[model samples]
Target: MNMPNYFELFDLPVQLPVDVSLLTANYQQLQRQYHPDNFATANDNDKMVMVQKSAMINDGYHTLKNPIKAAEHLLSLKGFDAATEQNIIHDADFLMEQFVLREKLEDIESQDDFVILDDFHSEVFARQHDVYKQLLEFINKQDWEAALNQIFKIRYLTRLIEQIEKLQEKQYAL
Candidate 1:
């Protein structure tokens, strides 16, 4: 059996800035067609095939849905090995900023000021949005270096956001 790529499976162009609504609609249609329930009475082989198809469809949807994963997939298609090259973030300034951000996150427990936490969260959120926009631009240009830098920043910001949420949960539990 021939396997269509994620973009082909979704009937979309293999690029960034996808139409999410259209993706959702296409995914829903594909899911309905391949849902295991539809093959309940079929032969074991047919049921197994349906199960695999469903898994592929779900994986495709999620991979395309997330900007980071989508970017990595696109890079791979363009002959760039993102997974192997991921460790080299060439922006020293950005690395320093990340270090500072991590330090602030570590200090969160000692800082009793909720306002400070709120401000930090807002700052990180804004930075995350900015990085995402920058990432899109880099992806559009196929500028691997810039895109990788932004991806690193976005990942760090995401982790920081998760940490912030955990801290908030702890505060609320008090």
Candidate 2:
């Protein structure tokens, strides 16, 4: 059976930046329409179908809500399965920057200053934002290769931010 993509299921455009309010409204509407309780009085086959549709609605909502997942889904719609693609970025400058960031993160953990961690978090967030913009631009131009690279950078920056937050939490628990 042919199935609609997440964007189609949500009645949304296939883009990275999705409208959260609309997505939430549509998700609630679909949940009400397809919730398993609504099919309790139906036939066995009908109940099963409703359960499946409800699951699809939930999965579509989550995949479209997350920027990274949404970007990956967009690439998949373009015949590029990013999950399985081995698109390794070999840019030296990018690699060096990541390495330096990691070193700074390690050093921040040993220090007792919250300001350092805050600054690091802001830097990583800014870098992630920049990469996200580039990803959007590349997706708009159909430059899948570049978009994939930017996705990797965004993922790395996200990880760095998470790590910084963890360190900050650890320090706070002192």
RMSD of each: 2.3, 1.6
Which residue runs does candidate 1 get wrong by more than 4 Å? Answer: 1-4
lDDT of 2 by residue, 34-133 (tens): 8999878999999888988998899988888888888998888887788888757778898899999999988888887899889989988988989899
What is the alpha-carbon lDDT for the whole of candidate 1?
0.83
Candidate achieving the largest lDDT: 2
For model 2, give the RMSD to the true fold: 1.6
| Candidate 1 minimal-lDDT segment of 10 residues | 79-88
The Cα local distance difference test for each model comes to: 0.83, 0.87
Q: Count backbone overlaps in model 1.
A: 0
Candidate 2 Cα misplacement greater than 4 A, ranges: 1-4
Tell me the tens digit of each residue's lDDT in model 1 across 1-174.
Answer: 443478889999877877788888999999999999999999999999999999999998998898787877776666665677666667788789889988987787687667787788898888898888998999888897778777777877898898987887787777
